[model samples]
Each structure stands twice: as C-alpha cells, then as structure tokens.
Target chain A: MAIRQLSVFLENKKGSLSEITNLLAEAKVDLRSMCIAETSNYGIVRIIANDPAKALEILIASGFAAQIRPVTAFAVPDQPGGLAQVLEILEENGINIEYMYALVTTIADKAYAVMRTDDEEKTEAVLAKNNIELLDEKNV
Target chain B: MENRKYYQPEFETMPVEDIKKLQSEKLIKQVKHVYENVPFYRARMDEKGVKPEDIKGIEDLYKLPFVEKSDLRDNYPYGMLAKPLADCVRIQSTSGTTGKRVIAYYTQYDIDLWEDCCARALVAAGADKEDVVQVSYGYGLFTGGPGLNGGSHKVGCLTLPMSSGNTERQLQFMTDLKATVLCCTPSYAAYLGESLKEMGYTPETIPLKAGIFGAEPWTSENRRQLEATLGIKAYDIYGLTEISGPGVSFECAEQGGMHINEDHFVAEIINPETGEPLPEGEKGELVFTCLDKEAFPMLRYRTRDICVLSRKPCSCGRTFIRMSKPMGRSDDMMIIRGVNVFPSQIEAVLLKEGYTPNYQIKLSRVNNNDTFDVFVELPPEQFDDSVKSISAKEASLRDAMRNMLGIGPAIHLVPPKTITRSEGKAVRIIDERKLHD
Candidate 1:
C-alpha cells in the first residue's frame, strides 16, 4: 500500500522541530507518522501525512526544504511477536529496513507499522505472498 | 615565470592638456550619439532644457544630471539600449540583492572596448603574455568572468575560464594548467588560500604569481593575507555591472590605488547628500560618464561608491586618475545608535584578524528599541577553539566596531564554514527590523 511521507532537511537547532510542527499545523496538514534522523549539526525529519504534495508545497513556500517519499504500511495483528514475524520474513527475503515507525490513531485493536525498505517492490511482493494485510489508501 | 614589473602611470605625468583634449573630443561625439540614438537620454536632455550642441566639451559634462542604479532599473530590459536588441551581442546584470537587477548590453564594439580596458588593467597588474591566467570570477549574466577572459586573451596570456565555485577543481586546474594569474573576489581568494593550506599545498609549489581580486570591497589587510598565503601580489580591480566589469579600473603593482579608465569613462567625486561635486582627495560618491560606450552610454552615472580620488601621477606610466578602493555605498550605510556603519567596515576588521568574511548583520527591534547582532562564520580551526577565547575575540571585535561605528553590536561566532558561499554576488547584510515593524 502507498504511504505518503515528507522528508525535510533541518539544521539542528533548539526550536527547529517545534517550528516545523507549528508550520504544519498552520497549514492544516495532518501528520500520521513521524521520525527524525540527526547528525552533528543537521537532521532529516520524515513524516507520513494525509496529503504529501500539499504538505511539501506548504513547507517549501515557507522556506523549509522538503521532499516526498513513498513507503509501505502493513497492518500487524495486535499479538506477541507480530512485528518480529514480519522482520523475520523480510530478513529471510534479504530486505533491509531503513527505518520503521508506528502511526498514531484512535483505533487500537490492530497495530500498524510503517516501514521504509531498500526494495519496496520486493518487500511488498513478499508480504503479499505471505498473506499479510498491507494497508492501502482505503485503510487510512 | 620571471619577476614581472607592473607600471603605474600618473595623470600629471601625461600631458594633461592632451588627455583633456582627447576626452573633450570623445565626449562631444558620445553626447551627439546618445542624443541621436537613445530616446531616454534624448527625453532627459530635452527635459533638462539642454541640447547636444550646448555641450561643447568635457566641462559641459557637469551640466548633465547624474544617472544612478535607480535610473537603470527604471529603464529595465532594453529601454535604455542605444542600438536594436538584434545588434547587441551580450547582456549582463548585477544581482538584484537589494532591488531590481540592472541589465547592461554590449555591442561588438563595446565588448572590444571593454577587453581593451581589461587588458590595460591586466598589463598594469604585471600580467605578461607568457602568464597563464586563471579567471575565477563567475560567468554568465555576471561580467567578471568574460571580462577577465577577454583581457587575458588580449594580453596574450593563456586564459583559464575557471569560473567561481568548485575550489578543488580550480586548484586542480591551477596545478595541472600551471596558472600564474588569478582573478576572483577577495573573499573567495581567502577561501581558496585556506583550502590550499588545508590540502598541504605550499605557495612555492603553486604556479600562481599574482592575483586581481574584486567584485566586492576588501581592505589592505585582507589583500596582504591573500598575498602572503598564495605567494602572489594581490591587486584590486574595481568595476560595476552598469559601467563594465573588472576593467573599469585596476591597481598597479605599486598598489597605490585603482586607475580609472579616464580615456573611456570620465570620473567625478560628489557629495552624497547635496549632489555637489567635491574636489580631488575628498571622500565622496564616485560617479562616471561614459565617453565611448555605444550600445548603452551612461552619462554622469552616480555609482554611490564612496571613495577618494587622486589626480597625482602614479609611479607606473598611465595618466589615468586613480580612486581609492571604495569605502562603502552611501545608500547601504546602516545607522545604529547615532553611528554610521558600513558592512565593508566590519568586513575589514574581521579579515585583518584572519577571519572569514562570511557574516550576517541582523538588525531587529526589541521592546521598542533597536538591537544589532552580528553572526560571523569562522574557519573550522577557529570553530574548534575554546568558547572563552571566542568570547574575548568578540569583545575586542565589539570594541573595534564601537570605535569605528560608534555602536556596539551583539556578536555571535558561528562554526567554521557555516556560512553559505555564493558563486555570483555575495549577500552581506540582513536587516530584520523592517520585517518586525
């Protein structure tokens, strides 16, 4: 399933995260999932949003450098070893997960793990063959 | 490369009477051409209640109103072009960092004249036909690159069209091509010098012998550092996009001041506030009147660059009038706490302390009061040093700025190489006061 993610290049500063979040709120872009990878002086803030294009446009118009990336989201059963089983399958299929984070939502019965993999097509195919419930646009 | 001697010609050394006679003839012809061709000039002349016939010689130049950057902007695109767009071969413009970018057109004759002026400047800087000149000034829409390229070609030097940016590539080209003459902005020259030292390349190993640095204002302290680091004699080349590029004037090896090409463009110093002409040696706004320009002839164009003029002859043999490297632009002057401060003034102090000129000055209002902050981007080595030492440095900088500008600004020492490097025109100051208000 398609996951719209916003990748932003941010210089490491005290209020940069808050600034971006405030900007998103002002633009009315709803964020579903978020993660940040930081180095010594700068960081990349990635987020899955309802409307990736609109979020990116708003960010750029506000002078924040941002890009869009497509990732995959899989609905996992809310049970023990649910994520572990998916990881094992991906590892067996030689798929490297760059990063994985959870989406925040009101529904708590089923768990969803959004992942960015090295080979998105292969990872999706492997998950599909294994009968894993991959969340699509309809699910969100 | 052998030791090449640069020549400086004094205007007095030349028979002034003869030079004046030549200027008068050129001026008369130029005035006639401007009246016949450019409608803008024609309209302005008509509005002034003056005619081409009324301007008899060089003395009549004073009767014309001074043209300025605003004038160029008012006549944007081809409004001021004397010739048809088809006849113009090239167009260049200054970056509209402050306002609208001023576009300049060049006919084939204009380009040739420009190259001749540049060649004269290069010769004055001790460049020889055998020298391999590396032009680091940016190309395309900026006149620095092509201006130097043409001049180097005219001087019979092996010209390297290595435009600005790509320091590593520039060094490689310098070493591989054995470039001896470098042309670039003074700030970038410092950056390149630092890069060479970091790479463990000594001046003795480098083929560079002399440099012509301009496109931005720099001080003698910075020039000395550049020379010492690169093992080259650094000369200042002054010009603006409106008049021409690097060829408007150049410093001879004597390093007294830049020699304005009086043969083509007439130079004058005037009071910035009153528009009244100032005598020689008085620090005022520099203005020019193009005498030989064809496609876009400018008359009494007020450059706004504040500098002193010297009519005294130079040791080298050219009879052209010399102007001090500009102090600053009157319009760009910032007033803080009843003190006048120019960005170039702070730049000079920072450069003398072996600091990069990558700085931004932020002016803001706090509690209905004006506050000034300076963020200086330092080299990596300086960035690694103790914060205490940096604080002391800032204190001294504040003191020096106060002494020079009569105002103290909060100084922030940023990490080395934190400031962005520009390939074309560098943005020097940022005023946030207007935004907040």
Candidate 2:
C-alpha cells in the first residue's frame, strides 16, 4: 500500500531544520518518520507526517522548498532480519530502492518500514506477490 | 620551418626611436581618418576643444579624448565604425556581460593585420610551418579561434581548427596528427593536460611542445602547472574583442611580459582615477590606440586592465614594448573560464526569474580550473517542497545564465534570508582564488 511522504529541501546551515520543525510545530503537524539525506551544499529531509499534505503546504508557505510523493509502506516480523528479508525479496525481484526508513508505529509483533524504489509499481507488485503485508495510509 | 626568427623582423626589431616615429606617423594619420569618418570621435574631439591638427605625435596622444567602455555601450551596433558596413567583412563581439554587446568591426585589411599579429605571436611562441598548430579556442563570433586559426595559416603550420570541447576528438587529433602547438585558455590547457595524464601520457610522451594561453588571467603558478602537466612551454597571449582579439600583445621566449605589437597598436599606461599617463614600469590602467585598424579603429580606448609597460630591451631581440600580464581590473568584471562575468548580469538573471536579487557568487580555482557557483535565496512564494521541482528550477536558471554568459554555473536555491547583508549591501562575491595576486 502507498502512503504520502514530504521531502523538504534545506540549506546546510545552522538552525535550518530547527526552524522548519518550529514552523511545523506551530502548524500542529506531527512528523511520524523522518530521515535526512545530506550533501555538501544542501540537505533533504524526507518525512512522513500525520497530515502530509497539510505539512507540505505549511512548509511551502513558510518559504521552504518542499515536495510530496507516494512511498510504499509494509510491516515485517518484529525481528533482527525483518528489513533484510524485505530487501532480499525486492533484490530478487530486481527492484532498486532509492531510499528507505523505519516508521514509529507498528502492528502487534510487526514493525512498519517505508520504501521508495525506482519502479514503484513493480516494487508494490513484487511485495504483494510475495504475500508481504502492506500498510495503507490509514494504517500508518 | 622557414628558420625565420620573427614574423615581421623589420617592425619587431626596429629601434626605439624608429618605433616611436612609426607610431607617431600612424597616430597622426589615424587621428585625421577617424575625425573625418567617424562622427563620434569628431564630436568627442570637438567637446574636448581638441582638433586633429593638435595631435602631432604619440606625445600629444593625451590631448585627444579617451573613449570609455560606457561610450561603446552608448554607441552599440555601428556607432563606432569608422568605415561603412559594406567595407566591413567580419564582426567579432565580446561575450555579452551586462548591457549591450561590444561589437568590433573588421574589414579585409583589418583581418589581414590581425592575422599578422597572430602570426607574430605564434612565431614568438616557436610555432612555424614545421609545427602542427591545434586551435582549441571557441570559434564563431569569438575571436580566439578565428584569430589564431588565421595566424596558424599565416605561419604555414598544419592547422587543426578543433575549436573547444569534445575531449575525445581533441586528443585523437592531437596525438594522431602530432600537434606541436596547442592554443586555448589556460584552464582548458590545464584540463587537457590532466586528461592526458589520466590517459597515461606524460610530458615526455606527449607531442605538444608549446601552448598559447590567454583570454583570462592566470598566475605564474598556473603557468608552471600547465607547463609541467602538458610538458610544454606555456606562453601568455593578450587581447580583447574590443580591440582585435588574442594578438594585441603576446609573450616571447623571454616570458618576462607580453610584447605589444607597437607597429599596429600604441600602448599607454594611465592613472585609473586621474587619467594621467604614468611613466614606464609603473602599474596603472592600460590603454590602446589602434593605429592600423580601419573598420572599428579605437583611439586611446581605455582597456581598464591594470598593468605596467617596459621599454627595457628584451633578450628575445624584439624591440617592441612589453606589457605585464594584467594585474587586475578596475571594474567588477571577472574573467571566469575565459568569459567575462559581472555581478550585475547575474543579478539581472535573478530578477528576471522572479527571485529576489539577494544572491552571492562563489568563485574558486580547483586543480587549475575555475569552479563557479551562484546561491540565490528562495522567496516564500516560490518555495517548493520537492527537491526534484527545486532542482529543475535551478537547472533552468543555469541554462538561462549559460545562454546569457556563454558559461554555465552551478545554481543553488538557499533558504530565504540566508544570504545575509551587511551595511544594507549584500556582499555579492566570495572569490577564494586570489586571482589578482
């Protein structure tokens, strides 16, 4: 199943992420899962918020370069090799993942993980064919 | 090779008095020619209360009015042409940097003399018919390629009009044809050298023996790097599209300073602020008076390049006066990778793109190459949360800048108010290269 993710472009400067968080806090938006990708010149903060659309709108209105995209989320056994198993299935199916991060919420005995791949349709199809449990936006 | 030492030995080896006499004669004749033909010069002369009869020789050159770069912009297309358009056969222009492009008209005779100057430069650089000359400078409207191309022909060398870029083909022809003389900007020469080294070729193994590099400022350190990397003697050639490109002045075997082609153009150093002529060997703004150019003859054109002139005899046996490599510019113009860039031009691009004019230019030299980056503040209204969308905007801005500047720079969209301003003025440029030093 697919859930929305917001990616914010920020300069690699002091207080940039803090300022963004402050703005989102003022807007009453909750960031569920987030990961930062850093480069020499700038950084990208990929986040899944309680209300992604609202968070994105507020970030843009506050003068931040941000965007929203659909990323697949799935639940795995709450064990050491849970992510490795999902990665193994995706690799065997030839689905290249651009990035992935773990989610805060999970089902009983299962951990939730978010993934973005080169071919989203194929990735979702392979995971579905493998019978791996997929989570929807409402589940996240 | 013809075993000839100089292209025009008579002019190049003339006595100091004879050179001055020749310049005076040409200046006197040129003054009357421009006064009679170009109304702009006449008006300036009239406004300054000076007449053609007053300019007897080079000593009285100060009596005439000095033409500034603004004057060129004020009279854009054909305003400064001393000859009619029909008589002009070619027009080479400076890469547009802010306002109107400065166009230089060239008649057939003007082209011939320009090529002759190039030939002199090539011969000075040890290029002859026996050497294969590869012209790597850009062609078409830019004078570096065409000027040196003609000069290579004049020198009777097997000329390769390779232009710029396409490293693979450049190397193929360079090695296959056994190119002995390479010509391009200092940075490009450095790149070719690095590429050659990566390809397992050393200076001893490379076929190149000499290189003519110019169209931008470079240091002796860069010269040493280019010379060692390419395994060739790197020589500096000086010129601008405003006053016939590439061969206005060039270095000889001595490599002390570039020798001005006094037989064609008269050189003078003047105080940048006061316009008073400075004596020889003192650094000041350099100026030129084209004595032979007919189509777009510029008289006492302020070059804005700060350098000194030397009359001390050179070991190279050329009696022509030598000009030190331009120390710095009097204006905010920066020669990045051999293209003129101005902060105002970058600011104009930002304003046109609906962004605030709050931007900063970061210039650095990495591995003997120039690295340029521009950082612009992202306005609140134009902020997009998507890195893809924002990166697309940056790419488009880079394309627009390349179209305007003839060189592309990495564009970064920084957060709003991040480009701090001091004293109500944003510090626009951060140059880490220390280019003037």
Q: Who wins the lDDT comparison? A: 2
TM-score of each: 0.63, 0.83
> Second chain TM-score per prediction?
0.75, 0.97
Tens-digit lDDT track of model 2 for B40-155: 99999999999999999999999988988878888888889999899999999885446567899999999999999999999999988898999999998889999999999999
Best by DockQ: 2
Model 2 TM: 0.83
TM-score, cand. 1 vs. native:
0.63
RMSD of 1: 13.4
Interface RMSD of each: 11.1, 3.3
Q: Which stretches of candidate 1 lie over 4 Å from their true place?
A: A1-78, A83-140, B1-13, B85-87, B97-101, B332-437
Fnat for each model: 0.00, 0.50
